[model samples]
Target: MKKNILYLSLAVIIGLLGGYLLFSINADSTNEDLTDNHNHLETTENQMWTCSMHPQIMQPEPGDCPICGMDLIPAETSAEGLAFNEIKMTENAMALANIQTTIVGSVEASDEDGIISLSGKIAENEENNAVQASYFDGRIEKLNVNYEGQKVNKGQLLATIYAPSLVAAQQELITAASLKESQPALYKAVRNKLKNWKLSDKQIDAIEASGSVRDNFPVYATVSGTVTEVIAKEGDYVKQGQPILSVSNLNSVWAEFDAYEKQISQFNKGQKIKVTTNAYPNKEFDAVISFIDPVLNNNTRTVTIRTTLNNKENLFKPGMFVTGKIEGAIHTTENSLSIPASAVLWTGERSLVYIKTNPNEAVFEMREVTLGVRNGDNFTITSGLKNGDEIVTRGTFTVDAAAQLQGKKSMMNKSGGKTMTGHEGHLGIQESNTENKPNSDLFMEMNLPVAFQIAFQAALEPYFKMVDAFVASDANQVLALAKTTLEKMKAIEESHLNKMENSHLSKSIEILDAISSNSDLKNQRDQLVVLNENIVALAMNIKTPSETLYVQKCPMANSNKGAIWLSTEKEIKNPYYGDDMLTCGSVIEEIN
Candidate 1:
């Protein structure tokens, strides 16, 4: 019995040892699996995060975009992703943004010359202008040319003057003729005196034959032209060498274009010009540059470039507005790349464009380009681009806005926010703080009348309403408010104000009228920029105590040149950007 018990104990001990060893091995394997799983979770949590709009921003954890204040998304960890400057867009995002691209190619060179556009007025050619004057002292007479603009011919009877001096001379001639047989020299002297008085030899001969003196002598036109001015009436007595009328030959006319100081260098005498007029839209008149005025108008800072155009068809009338174009050398270098003006975004002196870096993908990168000259709808590129490159031509502004949001290289942010310290000194805010503050003594200096002040204040109400509409991004409301503003402005009579005030009011009305006609929000906003400038001028020149106004500026507005608008409150609600960038501006001034 003792031996059987010992065997059972040994078997039990062996089985327990095997079970303990297997459990220990399984525990070590389980711990290893748990460690591997924890590492995988850590890797997922530490993935890089980036903003969809600002691709340049990268972070170790998911968060929001600092620039645009948008939600952050996971950045691509694959090696096949785009480079630092390049931005990738999905097909849906591109369609939503309406982004379009164009494949660049070499444009065929042509012999056509570039055009230099000019604005001017049709004026009378002073060289062809003539003045009709009386040759002898006269009494009341019959005038043939009744009104201004009357056509006259050379030697045509213009007037008949009843001159006592002429009658006396003729009587003397008759007396001299009677004594001719005895004194021939005296007869010849009288005849010569009559000839000097503009009397024809035939008239002198007739007077001698009839032995009578004429009561009146006829005056004839010295040149053929249209009557420009009738200086003296027929009933009024005139002295010898006194101007009666001014005539201008309409066969030729002068086109006087106002050339800015910068454009004066492009003008030269004998250059061919093609002129078009509003009166005859289909017809184009050819002319040659006759002269460029040596003196520049100090106030206007412009010189007059005169071109003589043939007016044989009588189509070009005086005082008509015209546009002249001169063929000249192109401002751009040969074989340079040219892109549409819309494709460029200007930031002060910097000009930038978006180039498609990848043909197979929607990848774009911002590039700074050197601008040469601006053609009508195109701009000549002097550097920073090459042929056969693809670029964004349409919706470029939208693309730039996206780039700015993504913290990429843009017109406003060149370093792509890599060194961005904070938003404490934003461009719009900084400019508003220092530059455009209203003067406290501005109203005190203006000696405006009370009645005129009331009228000006009333005109600002509709303008305020329009500002609210733009803030809300309601285009329909903007249109309605613009019309109401225009009506109020037109109702303000200019006669109530003094000369300077009237001038300011008239300009404001004209700009408001233009704004009222445009239904497009962008166009209306552009005009609003000018309208606000005029309002500021008016406010500075005239006191309006009944209302308080605020002048705001958006450095990003008007293609980044910056634009100003009038507001009722100190807070900025940018009219230029509407909701796209609602808080993109700041209050610059306070007016009362």
Candidate 2:
């Protein structure tokens, strides 16, 4: 037994020594590997942090983002070898943002030949218009061409009229025909009177041969054209010489253009112009200015210019929008550079553009351009730009956003955000050059298009009803109203919104969908905090001031974070707290 125990102990001792040696070897290898790569690894103390939503918030340590109240992530190193005025963007970002660039050209060398553009809509040519009038006083018994846009041919039966006077006249014609041998002069006079009623000689002879007095007479179309209006309906009495139908020769149309007072000098009667419409973007219709209004419109500061277009194929509609381009005076290359109007951003009194700094890479910088004159869809840069310099012609706003995220100057004015009272958590994205005073008209400078404003106004009406539902704390009603409001929002026209505002609108839709699915009041209100950010941003910039909207804020809502909702009334009806704090909110801003 002692010999067996000694052998086991020796085996155990050998296993322990082998394990120790392997551990020591691993420890030494790990130490060498780490020490060798220590220089390459980034230190935790030196790491920077930034927000995913608001990339401008950069901090030295890991914490929640000050702007969004979200956890920060390690910041990516910026592109090196860039000038102070330049900002570098990745190729992926450029493609995703749809950043497009175009080389600036001289106004004289442009394909448009520095054309002066005029905005107007297609109108019916009045020169070839004719009115179908009744030759005799009668009541319309039947109408063949009843509605507008009906085609009518010359000599086609338009309507049948019932006339007692015509019946008496027809009786006289038969009597006069019977007594023609006795009173030849009287018979001729009676025949002449019947001829005066626009009756053909055959029709009068047939009536006399049948020896009958017809009460109904047929009226034929005097002109071949489209019926524009039906003045006299069936079973209605029409006086002699009264218009029964309006006929317009639609083989031609008028391309009426509105020229601003500044462009009036460039236009004259008999000037040749190129007219185009969205329907036929690839085609240009040549026309001559037929007329120019002698007086300028005081309300619009514009004058009317008329051109006639051949529309034999029915290509031009009356309400179709059209543009008239007239060749404008061209300047030398040294005089000015022409760039697309989409590339320019107007901020306060400054016109800004983004220049593609690198020819081979995606690097951009902001430029304050001196705008000279706007010609057609292009603008003339007097001094700020030079020929062959590439600029952002499309997605200029997206480039501006990228520049903003990179801590670079952008088209957005260095002006501060709205510094409203009562905790503006969502609106606290401070600009780099705010000078410590926030401009209350934060979104006023956004330059929302009239089309977007009109659509948003239509959608916004239903949102107030949804707010009222929230104020009543009726979750089911809120859900129904959310659906209704969302339905309205789906119809909103987003083509006119800028890139940033479009993004805001998209996010608002997502939050609203979440709010619609949930029944909990707290959850819905929580989502409202984010949704209101987008809505208020749009509201502050609406160019169409139709009504007085009170922007009421409740600081205690959104879990101590403030939230706002627009109201048509001055009274505060708290949507967040309902009856518990119905009047807890205060008016922060009023959108007129």
Which pairs of residues clash in candidate 1, taking residues 3 or more apart in a chain or in different chains? 53-406, 54-406
Looking at candidate 1, the ten consecutive residues that score lowest on lDDT are 425-434
19-138 per-residue lDDT for model 2 (tens digits):
999999999999988986684454555455665654544455677654446787776654556777676665544554457899987666547665677777898899989999888998
Total residue pair clashes for candidate 2: 0
User: Taking the tens digit of each residue's C-alpha lDDT, what string does model 1 give over 1-592?
Assistant: 8989999999999999999999999999999889988987876765556556544444555665543456767766521466776766555446545678987654445544376567778899889999998888996589989799899999999999999899889989999999999999999999999888778899899999998778988888999999999998868999988989899999999999877565677778999898998778788888888999999865345688998888888988887878887887355455777787667765434678899998988778998898765444566777888997899986575566456544577655678853221222111100111124332222224456776677777878888888888887555577678778888888776665654455446656755665655444555665566566556656665454565777677877755546677777777788887666888877766776
Candidate 1: lDDT over CA atoms? 0.71
Number of clashes in model 1?
A: 2
Which 10-residue span in candidate 2 carries the lowest summed lDDT? 430-439
RMSD of 1: 14.4
Assess each prediction's global lDDT (C-alpha) against the native: 0.71, 0.73
The runs of at least 3 residues in candidate 2 whose Cα sits more than 4 Å from the true structure, single-residue gaps closed, are: 1-70, 74-95, 100-122, 168-197, 200-209, 231-233, 236-242, 258-260, 274-286, 295-304, 311-333, 346-376, 383-391, 399-415, 418-592
